[model samples]
Target: MKLIHAELIKLASLLSAWIAAGLATILPAAVAVLNSRSQVSRGIDAGFQDLAPGVIGAIVIGVVAVSSEYLVEGAESGGGRQITTSLTAVASRSRFLLAKAAAVAVTVALLALLSSAITLTTTSLTDETVSVGTADLPRVAGVTAYWILTALLASGITLVTRSGIVPLTFCIVNMSVVSVSFLLTKLTSWANYLPDLAGMHLFLRDVHGSVDIAPLTGGLVMGLWVVVVAGIGFIVFRRRDA
Candidate 1:
């Protein structure tokens, strides 16, 4: 409990978390508002599509949470990295990593929920024709789950690299409006199985040029990716020097 609380406090103290949260809340609504004015048909899954921009915020949350620990406070003063301090205090790498993961998961989940709610409400208000049916409730839930999973994925990758730049750049670029994965899907069918693309199938009603998997199956595939990557990260963190 102490470890988890400490991890939470450490995360809360970072400016990146607040910035990510703010972006997560505002970006989606702004996109929805702009989308409402356009007559172009964004297909049946427009709500989820409109909320896509907010995923960047979740990615940032995950990357920064793990990467911040590796940053040097003052190299000249020999302050060392926060990871050293964290490990010294906890004295158990596994426990500390788990605590950090738990803190990030909880924080990202709350951010996802709030951002999803805001985006959904704004989209509905702006475009009355956009109606969500009873069957779509599961997809709405899937959106939140997808955001959480993406955040975890980022966190795990950051742990392995011990640097935010690489993971952040790759994730953000791969998930952008004209994503490389999406483009590659046109040339190769296997590209659809990429983590981001497969995960998006969980909530997307009409995905273009991708494998057609059930929502539950899509979520499972994405979850499996997170598990594998995060497991590897945990192992490396345990064996490597702080």
Candidate 2:
């Protein structure tokens, strides 16, 4: 509990984390408003598309959580790293990893919840074509899970890479207008199974290609990917010197 609390404190103190939260909360709502004002087509899934890029915030949060620990201070500060102090404080690698992951999960989940509410509200108000209602609740809940899983994957990848540059850039590029997954889908149906693409099935009814995956199945596939990635990260973290 203390370890988790300490990790939460560390996350709270990070300017990047706070910036991520603000970006996560605002981007979707702003997009939704713009799309609505532009009078987007009255499709059932019109506004939901705006929520996609907002996951960038979750990715940033996850990356920084792990990357910050490895950052070495300047020579004036004795060129020390936070990971050394963190490991010294908590001898149990398993507990420390769990605490760090838990903190990221909780923080991302809350941020997702807030972003969903604001974005959905903006969509409902600005886009008179679609009214937010009871039917939208499940999708709202799913986004929280989606963002949490995304954040975990980011953190796990950071653990394996030991730097944010690769995972962060890869993920941000994939979330951009021309996504690798989207491009891959043009060549093969299997691309739908990618973690980000598969997870979109949870909250999105209109998905890529003719592949029809149930929401539950989408969640499961994403979860399996997380387990695999996080497992590898755990093994590496336990075996490697901090």
Candidate 3:
């Protein structure tokens, strides 16, 4: 419990978390407002679809949690890394990782919830034709779950790499520039089961792909990926020297 609290405090202190919060809230809300006010007619699902871009924020949350620990201090600070101190204090790698992961998950879930509320409300006010009601609660919950899973995926990758560069770039690019997995869907229907693609079904009514994934099935598939990545990261984190 102490470890979890400490980890949460560490996350709260990070500027990256604040930047991530901005991405999660601002991007979606801005998109919703634009969709609402624009002359171009969009489906009533515009608000929900806007949530897609916010995954970048979730990815950032995961990467920075691990990456921040690995950052080496300058020579003036004895050129040491925080991970060494963290491990020295905790003594148990599993406990430390678990606590850190929990912290990241909690931070991301809250961000997701906030983003959903702001974005949905923006849409509802901007376009009276779009209504958000109790029925959308489940989808909102799904969005939070999706963000948690996405954050975990980023955390797992960062743990193994011990650096944020690769994981952060890949995840941000995948969500922003172009989806490598989404492109693969053209060649194989099974690509529809990829984490991001499947996860989108949780809140999105219209996914531009050939395969049709039920929300529950998509969540299951994404969850499976999270388990696999987390397991691999745990093994690597345990065996590798800090």
Cα RMSD to native, each candidate? Answer: 1.7, 1.2, 1.1
Which has the higher TM-score value, candidate number 1 or candidate number 3? 3
The digit string of per-residue lDDT tens for model 1 on 1-242 reads 88889989998899988998899889988999999899987778777787777889999989998999999888675978888888889887888888888888888778877877788788778888887557767777888888889999999999999999999999988877468888889899988777787888878878776578777877898999999999999999888888
Ranking by TM-score: 3, 2, 1
lDDT at 135, model 2? 83
Which pairs clash inside model 3?
none
Local distance difference test scores for all models: 0.86, 0.89, 0.91
Q: Write the per-residue lDDT of candidate 3 for residues 99-216, one digit (tens) a residue.
A: 9999999989999999999999988899888888998999999899999999999999998899999999999999999899999988998999989999988988788889888999
Q: After superposition, how far is residue 175 of candidate 2 from its true place, in Å?
A: 0.8
Off by over 4 Å in 2: none
TM-score of each: 0.94, 0.97, 0.97
Q: How big is the positional error of residue 61 in model 1, measured in Å on the Cα after superposition? A: 0.8
Of models 1 and 2, which has the larger TM-score? 2
